[model samples]
Target: MKLRGKTCLVTGANSGIGKITAIELAKQKARVVMLCRNEEKAEKARQEIYKVSGNTDIHIILCDLSSQQQIHDAADEYRRRFTSLDILINNAGIIAGNERLETADGFELTFAVNHLAPFTLTLLLLDLLRHSEAGRIITVSSEAHRFARFDMEDLQLKHHPYSGLNAYCISKLCNIWFTRQLAALTSRSKLSVNCLHPGFVASNFGNSASAAFKALLILSQPFAISNEKGAATTLYLAGSEAPEHISGHYFKDKKIKKPSKAALNDAYAEELWEKSAALTRLELHKVSLS
Candidate 1:
């Protein structure tokens, strides 16, 4: 597809699947905006995307997805730069290792970086996105969500014991929940919100885990797909003509697939939407297109 006139933002684009996705989008001639924490690494990734796609319109804005203030500032900067946004790939995420670290915003690392940040950024940029003929919000959730239904009661992983796998699963589940809620909010509009799992990709996730867990991840990763291969489903959902009419669903291999029972529950979706509004302190009245 030709995204010649579109402006796209891909978070966590300094490396891994996010980088690959950015390169693929740039090949289609979309003006790319990279939201990354590290300027040195992001600058390198910008150069790489230019070389790979032979498109030099890539722009990098430094913002740590882990920090709420930075996310807001980045959104403001982006709004000032672009008249409208066509595509938003909430691809920035983290898989915390054994030790739990808190973000500058006082949130658990995995939860804040993976789920809260994207949700906040998406909500912050809604007006600009709604201005487009067709705006797409693609959330890269995971199959790990099957095991981790969002326990709103234990959102901060307080009551529940923290295992790396469990925390990651909860974050992924939140991603899908947010996507479905967004789909409902944007229904009958110019926006389409969706989520998908990229399958198991051999990436830095293993390296981010603890030593023994990293060993296990690496061992299992041998059977996993490469990042380029893992990018296929997301690229299809993001750039393909087929998904234009599709929204609020999960896909794999370009086909709509069944998500978990919890994923399809409207009650859960509503609960999540309300809770997220409270958690992120979003003023929905200003954003409501209804």
Candidate 2:
């Protein structure tokens, strides 16, 4: 389906694969709402998107995914501006390395931004998304999830020595789990939810790599996909016709891939969903699937 006149919101649309995906979506005539944390950076990227695509319909709102209050305000502002939404892309994420730190909300920075922020935002947007003929939730996950499973007892990473990549891996795993849970909840609803690993995109996102990972980045950067190439799969999931009936699957290069065993566990998905609701203190009234 052509995205012409369709409204889509892409978190972290100002850079990396998210930036290219936003540009491609705009090229398809979709009106994009870029949710970014930094105003100056977002505006610069916005202008670049407009300059290249000649699509002046792009707008920006500042919302730091690391903070709960900021996410609420961002969602409120977005709802106030848009009507009849079609797509919601949860592409914002982070990796806090070298030192363990928490967001203003007292959650690990990586977990907060990479997992909880999108989870919270999606719940808030369900009402608007359900208003559409069909809605899509494209969560940008990572292959790193293969390294770790959700530690249900310590979702906050308070008890153990923190490893940045490990935290990031679990967060991405939560992304897939969230997708499955949300999709199951909306099975009879009009919305769809799916997650993807961008295939090791050559982006600056790994700059915070724990000293150990920096070497890995240097070694892998040469073989990593470019920004536009990395964005192709996301663009397809966000706008392609083939994915209309698909939901809760992990995708790469426009195809479904087998996720790790942990990602497919119904029990874990449910546990994570409940834990997330408790953490955010947000109740999502599930629509009947029957």
Quantify all predictions' global Cα lDDT against the true fold. Answer: 0.83, 0.87
In model 2, pairs of residues that clash are none
Worst 10 residues of 2 by lDDT: 281-290
Per-residue alpha-carbon lDDT of candidate 1 for residues 1-290, written as tens digits (9 for 90 to 100): 34787888889888888899999889988899999999999999999999999999899988988888898899999988878888899988877787767787678888888888988999899887888778888888888888984577776676667776678888888888888888887787878788888888887765677777777877797798998987787788778565475778887766787889887888887887787678778788888552
Off by over 4 Å in 1: none
Compared with the true structure, what per-residue lDDT tens digits does model 2 show for residues 47-146? 9999988999999989989989998898889878876678999998877685878988988888899999999998888877877777888899988889
> TM-score for all predictions?
0.95, 0.96
Error of 1 at 223 (Å): 1.2
Q: Worst 10-residue stretch by lDDT in candidate 1?
A: 237-246
Please report the candidate that would top TM-score against the real structure: 2
TM-score of the candidate numbered 1?
0.95
At residue 207, candidate 1 shows an lDDT of: 61
